[model samples]
Target: AQSVTQPDIHITVSEGASLELRCNYSYGATPYLFWYVQSPGQGLQLLLKYFSGDTLVQGIKGFEAEFKRSQSSFNLRKPSVHWSDAAEYFCAVEPSNTGKLIFGQGTTLQVKP
Candidate 1:
């Protein structure tokens, strides 16, 4: 079974500052990693995903993630974040060949002016 862990429960960053959210996974083999962002009163939006090929993948809303095999981490990053980026971020992992997703506890982002 695969699981996702987001060590940080909450993080605050200034508007227009860089942001990095950590995501670690526990799996015997390489598992699919996904990042999703949920705004207040909104559904989850797929930020990015790591399936194969490239270690670094680009996603929507100026977001990107890098999959590190050695660390079993797939961390999301943004060079510059905006106030609109404030949301709850979730990390998820899909076990081998299973369509089910195991989500992390989620990290909340607070943007400061």
Candidate 2:
């Protein structure tokens, strides 16, 4: 079984400030991890993914994440936030073969100018 947990329900960051969103997961083995962003009234867009090799993966919109197997965590980060970055972020895990994903509760980011 695979599960994701995003501890923060909401977060506020000033425009141009650095941001980091925490995520944790539990699975039977090494699972595929991903980060997705969904703006209001919009569909989820894949931010980044970790399947193998490099622990650090770069994503679109200047976002990146690192998979820490020891900690069972994959945290998303951005060097600078923008007002347009406000949205709901979800961390998900794929158990493979099931073609399904277990998603976290989601963290809503509010960027203030």
Candidate 3:
């Protein structure tokens, strides 16, 4: 079974500041990892995914993440925050057999200018 946990329920960041969101997962084998962002009343958009090779992966909107196998962590990071980045971020994991994803509760990002 695969599962994900996001420790932060919500976060606030000043515009143009750095941002980091935590994610942890439990799985038997290497899992397909993903980060998604959802704006208010909108669907989730894929930020990035880690399937094979490379511990670090970059995604849209200048977002990136590093996969740590030992810690079972995949944390999202951004160099600069934007007001448009204010949204809900979710961490997901796909199990080895099934294509379905198990998602975390999600962290709502509040941007302050």
Candidate 4:
């Protein structure tokens, strides 16, 4: 079975600063990852995904992720943070295209001025 882990349960970032959310997966083969963000009262929105080809994947809202096969990591990075960016970020993996997604516990982003 495949699983995802978000080491940081919560992260505080200053507004206008850079942000990086860690995501690591445990799988025997190359697995795809999707990053989703959920606002306070909204459904999950797809930020970015990694299927194949380029290791560096670009996402919406000025976000990008790098797929590091050696490290088994697909970390999400934003050059700068915004106050509106504060939300619950989730890292999900689809096991064998089963239509079932294994998601991390989720990381809450708190932005400060």
Candidate 5:
């Protein structure tokens, strides 16, 4: 079984400031990690994902994440924060061959002007 954990339930970042969201996972095999963002009253959108190759993966909206196999972590980062970036971000892992997902509780990002 695989599980994802996001320590912070909420995060606040000033506009133009750098932001990072933490995520940890536990799985028996090489897990497919993903980051998704959901704006208020909107559907989830894929930010970035790590399946293989580069440990660092680039995503939309100036977001990127690095996959650390030893640490069992895939942390998302953004160089600059914008007001529109405020949203609920979820860390999920494809746990089974069926591509079933196990998602973390999610972290809500708050951007301040």
Candidate 6:
């Protein structure tokens, strides 16, 4: 079975400051990893994904993540955040065959200007 855990339930960042959100997974094999963001009262939008190749992947809205096999982690990072970046972030994983995904509880980002 594949699963994900996000230790932090919420995080706060000042505008123009760096940000990082943690993610950890448990799976038998390499899984398809993804990070998604949802604005208030909105659906989720894919930020980035890690299927193969490079460990570090970049996404829209100046977001990036690195997949680390040893730590079973895929943490999201941003050089500088904006107030509009405040939203709920979810980390998900899809096991080999199944299209269904397992998502972490979520991490709410609070951006202060």
Tell me each candidate's TM-score: 0.97, 0.97, 0.97, 0.97, 0.96, 0.97
lDDT of 1 by residue, 1-113 (tens): 66889999999999989999999999999988899999999999999988999999999999999999999999999999999999999999998869889999999999999
Q: State candidate 3's TM-score.
A: 0.97
lDDT per model, in order? 0.95, 0.95, 0.96, 0.94, 0.94, 0.96
**Candidate 2 whole-model C-alpha lDDT, 0 to 1:** 0.95
Report model 1's TM-score to 2 decimal places: 0.97
lDDT of 4 by residue, 1-113 (tens): 68899999999999999999999999988877899999999999999999899999999999999999999898999999999999999999887777778999899999999
Model 1: lowest-lDDT 10 consecutive positions: 93-102
Better of 1 and 3 by lDDT: 3
Clashes of each: 0, 0, 0, 0, 0, 0
Residue ranges of candidate 4 with Cα displaced over 4 Å: none
- What's model 5's overall lDDT? 0.94
TM-score, prediction 4:
0.97
In candidate 3, which residue ranges exceed 4 Å CA deviation?
none
Could you give candidate 6's per-residue lDDT for residues 89-111 as a string of tens digits? Answer: 99999998588899999999999
Residue 62 lDDT, candidate 1, scale 0-100? 93
- Residue 66 error for model 2, in Å? 0.4
| Clashing pairs for predicted structure model 2, backbone only | none
Model 4: ten consecutive residues of lowest lDDT? 92-101
